[model samples]
Target: MIKNGYRNDCFVASVLLTLYANFGELGGVEKLFRRIGDKDITAWNSMILAGARPGHGSSHSMQLLQELCQTTLLQIESATWVAVLKSCENESDLVAAFVDIEWKDDSSWSSIIGTYKQNDMELEALGLCNCKEMLNEGVNFTSYSLPLCFSACSQLSAICEGKQLHVLAIKSGYNRDVYVGSSIIDMYAKCGNIEESENVFSEQLEPNEVIFNAMICGYAHHGKAQQAIEVFSKLEKNCVAPNHVTFLALMSACSHAGYVEETLHLFTLMLDKYKIKPKSEYYSSLVDAYGRAGRLEEAYQIVQKDGSESAWRTLLGACRNHNNTEIGEKSAMKMIEMNPSDHAPYVLLSNIYNAEGKWEEAIKCREKMAKIHVKKDPGNSWLV
Candidate 1:
């Protein structure tokens, strides 16, 4: 097309740029972008999207947006801002782009808040959602934003903030939304108020699979294995099909309560009855259940069959508690081979040796960590 003198056409050039970006042809995109003499907003946005394309570093996208802001007279709209925001790889870059947006629309607000949630900046996400300035600017919280806000509250265990958001949901008539209801349940349960979670769940007029799953997970987290099982039975009676999450939560509940046989039964039911393939997390949960029962050999056998690094780590931690140096050594060795840079396996190994009264072996584990410069991560307390 360029050879046919279509290079000067902004629309044609923009389409070509998107095609190249989608194909991961960054070099072709760069050359073609430079050759476009008259660039419109469409052309500029295409270039930005190209830079923001997955696997291509977002740095170039951010740089192009910066350059476009300083050089181009073309009006940067919400779409342009959203495109660049998608490329922000870190919190600082995202905040900078957000500040640069001339008009903060719902899309922009949702993008920033969602990014904050994804980056584990739950506090920041919640703060922005409830920011007085944001509300005064007439940025109404939509159903999409409400769920995200509730999730942030759940992560922080901010029951006070969560209740405030819950009231907002009710006022906005979004409390009936299945997603919002589910989030409310999760927030309440995670904040150590399972009764409130139950209230939220029971108040739903027509709960779906997601709502049931949320309630079950809440019960599981609180070690209410019987309640979780009853919920599962109710789900079956209601003809609501259970997903993988349902089984996962049930297995977790059994594991927490040291119900190894029930956990095993659930795993079998997931595979044979539900025909849902078990994930690595399922295997890890299974190992955890057996380990909690002090059945290290059974856990080891399960690990050998289809264990991931996480499952091996679970077994190693179990071995530490059981003071079984033989399995602990093997589990640690397997985990280290899977991720040599990880400090968790080494730390668990040291703990196991210490538990067994092998000070020299524990010292050796520490020395090895020092030699590899694999520093242990310091723990932090969760702020209430």
Candidate 2:
């Protein structure tokens, strides 16, 4: 086409750019992009999507959008931002894109709202959720939207709002939905309404593993470990086969209660009786259990055997909590060796030195971090 002088056409060039980029020909895309005299939103969007692929700068899409926003009169659409979100690594950035969208459908709203609530932006999530325009537009209030809103209220401990939603659920007939029912249980428990959570649990009909998991996890979170154990025992009696998540919740209960013997017994049953493999997260949880119980050596040995970065970090944090400098230093060194680029182990190791008043050692650790250019991320705290 270029040989036939179709290269003079911006539309053809833009289409060629997209095709080439989609075919993994970045070079061809760049060539066609350069030949186009005037790049418009379509051409820019294609280029941004291409750059957002793996092994490319994840921020390139955002950079292109910024350029387009400054240069073009074209209105940004839902597709454009959704494409940008494909490359977003953090929820905060997603929120940045989300707030700019002038209009969206149910799926878009549900997706962003759920994501916002997940990233601890309950306030922002709920704000959009209750946006009067959305309500006026007659957005569907199905199971999807209700759970996240309830979750936000629960997380914020907004019991009055949660009850309001429960009322809404009853009126809307969403309370019977399994997903909504589970979220309702979780919300009640999170908001410290144990009685309400229990009532919801008892009222559930033909509940699945997820609902049972929610109830057990809620009990575990509230320090009612024995109750959690009782719930686990009831699973078999109810003829519901427990998944690994069920055992994780049950093990977490034992761990929280400092029932070391019981925790170990459950771990064995999870493997031999239930035929479940101990994932890295389960190992980390086990390490946490021992660490919290002042059983440092046991935790350290388990972490050492597991050899997962997260497990080692968990053990290291436990050492820090217990003020066990020796284990902390060792764990920190191992973690740094495993992933030299991460700032967490470096910061924690330096803190361990500082905490022990080893000024020279602390200075050395700090210097190493500086030399490696590993900048510790600033800490963030969320109210809800």
Best-performing candidate as measured by TM-score: 1
lDDT of 2 by residue, 292-330 (tens): 898999999999878999999998888877878889989
lDDT scores in order: 0.87, 0.79
RMSD of each: 5.9, 8.5
lDDT of 1 by residue, 112-193 (tens): 6876787678987888777465677777777788889899999999999999888888887888999999999999999999
**C-alpha lDDT (0 to 100) for residue 179 of candidate 2:** 91
Candidate 2 is scored at a TM of 0.64
C-alpha displacement of 290 in model 1, angstroms?
0.6
What root-mean-square deviation over C-alphas does model 1 reach?
A: 5.9
In the predicted model 1, the residue pairs found to clash are none
Which lDDT value does model 1 have at 77? 58
